[model samples]
Target: MLFFSGKGGVGKSTVTAAMALLAAQQGKRVLVVDVDAKGNLTDLFEHEPVGFKPVEVHPGVHVMTMHTEESLQEYLRLNLRVPVLGRIGPLARALDFVATAAPGVKEILTVGKVCWEVRESIEGRADWDVVLVDAAATGHIVAQLGAPEAIRDLVSVGPVRAQTEWMSDLMHDPAVTALNVVTTPEEMPVNETIELVGRVRSELQVPLGAVIVNRVLPELFTHADEETFEAMRDPAAVNRLVDALGGGPDVARGTTAVLDAARMAVSLRRTRAGHLAELRRAVDLPTLFLPYLFVREHGLRVTRMVAEALGEELGL
Candidate 1:
């Protein structure tokens, strides 16, 4: 099981979806649980939002959303044998209260559900080869993953305590679980990731996984390559190229536009390099960089592109 967390817009959902697809392509049954209320992880596979019930959107990938009510319902039905049977309606508003006052009580509902799926799968009661969680963002992830420890210390002699013991064992086991952070090579995102990494190592029991860097713009040229490209932009060389392609005002404008775009890309990559270096120095974990997609729309098409990139990165 892998929990993916990072800044809200750092493409965390996209990366998680891509990983699900990549795992499916590798013949693994992948279950992706969207832990955010407004999650669009299923949408990346061109499916509409789903409830706690998982929907198999791709060949070997299932997607589901995490709702506190649903998690509680499952907990009662399975753990306590309370037979809720659609009877949690009145307790819905109370969920918010528990979240505010009891803290880990609300978080355990989510994390426990995630850990349940993984344990069931391993024990042969479920069919997931891999469980990927689009977990809470940087601000909330540690608390979410740490719920088991909190509950174990506070509760005694009940299903909840038993749940915590098992979840903690599964979560803390380096072989079974990993928490991976997704971030972009930008100031705020990188800084937040660095801080989150520190917190995870110090405060959480989950083992760290690779830092997945998303939307990276690969440098388009070496210094020598840039010198050659610069020469191509020289007035004389530009004139010759324009004549070679049959010169016209429109052609000249297009040529200038392309050259300017390349120059801007080179500059932008150089600027992001500093942030990437900082992230590397601050976080000692395996890293994978996913190149930026030059697309206007996002859906399964873009998801597949990222999945293919993931396959390459994983040497699949």
Candidate 2:
């Protein structure tokens, strides 16, 4: 089981899709689970996947949406066999109450659905070599992961308890599960990534697979280019440019002409590299760097690029 988790808007869905597609290409049947409330994974694929049912979004790629309410209703009706207090309309209200009032009940139900998928995948009944979960952002990831444990602790003497315990064990098992934290080269993301790595180690005790640094800028300047850039910035160089251009003693225009947009791009690239290096040192995890994608929209092209990056990083 491979989990792509991080803060919101960190391209977890993108990474999950790329990994799943690559896994499928490698002859491993793959299922990409959309566990986020926003259903971002569905958007990455071309097809729409209904909640709680696996849909083939691509060849060798199955997709499923995990909704808290749907999981809760399924659990209550099928597993718990609790007759509803009212009709469908009122059932929604009751579910809403349980979702909010019970605290972590929704989380448990959602996680239980994922646990079912994992178990099914292991049984060889499903045509999936791996289950890729595009999990929720950092804000709710902890509660989501702890859901099985919560249910296990709450009901200690029943079938539900037994099932929850099994799921909890699966989550805590390092051999079966791996968590990858996605981050960018910015301050907020790097800080959050460091904190998340520590939390996963201290709390979940799960192995931290790698820190995926997305949208990293390429270093365009070689050592010779750096020397040229530095020399161009010297005052004497500016004076030479003024003489060469014959710009009537306008040093600002001459200097500005020499320092074009390439200088800013070079500077920004260096700054981004510095941030990435700092994050690498702080986390001490294998950092996979993905190039900055200049596409107008994200689609299979970006997904393929991500897969290539993963392949290079994993040496597969």
Candidate 3:
């Protein structure tokens, strides 16, 4: 299972969707699970409202939005071996109360469901080549993924303990699971990612797969362009350019706007480069870069372009 997580607004959903598409393109049965309540994956696929059941968004790519209530009911139905209880009202409400009252119980149900999928297969063949979880942001992801271990420690001798133990093993096994931390090449996002890597390594003991740098700005200015900009800082150079462009107030204003935009672009690129360098120095993981999409709105077409670029980057 490949779990993708990052700060909110880091475009982790887009990255997860793109990677799922790439996996499907490679003929893998891919399940893209959106654990976030925001249903960002639903938006990315432009699909009808996704419920508990898995919906095929692409050829071999299935998407599902995980809800805590549904996950709890499924967990009880499977573990208790009483399918009727999962549907009945009084039992369902009682189970919901227990899940809500207990901290991390809801999370355990959710993560346990994911682990169950990882361990299941059809006719000795793996059910899914990859289970890509578009998990919650960094603040809550560690707790969500660590739910099994927490429950295991608390419940020493019971069926719940046994279940959590299995889930924990699946998560901790380097061969079975890995985490991908996504971030933009910016200060706070990079800092949060670095911290998240540390926690995942030391606390969760999960294998770190890769650090994905999303929405990286393209470096458009050359060294000569920088020199030209420096020269344009002079009033004489600005006047000359305005005169060359038919010497009017409008021409002067246009020249100023163009220079300002160029300068802003250069500044932004430098900032992103510095953050990328810092991320490399601090986090010891393979870092993948995804370019910023310059579209008015993101849709299936743009997602495909991102998937193609990501495929090339990861050699998928």
Best-performing candidate as measured by lDDT: 1
- Model 3, position 182, has a per-residue lDDT of 92
lDDT by residue (tens digit), candidate 1, 148-217: 9988887777878877888999999999999999999999999999999999989987999989999999
Clashing pairs in 1: none
State TM-scores per candidate: 0.93, 0.85, 0.92
Query: Comparing 1 and 3 by TM-score, which wins?
Result: 1
Model 3: per-residue lDDT, tens digit, 269-315?
99999999999999989989999888888778877988998988988
State which candidate, 1 or 2, has the greater TM-score: 1
lDDT of 2 by residue, 204-242 (tens): 655667788887877878989889987977889866777
Which residue runs of candidate 1 sit more than 4 Å off their true CA positions? 232-248
| TM-score, cand. 2 | 0.85
Highest TM-score against the true fold, candidate: 1
lDDT of each: 0.90, 0.77, 0.86
- Ranked by TM-score from best down, the candidates are 1, 3, 2
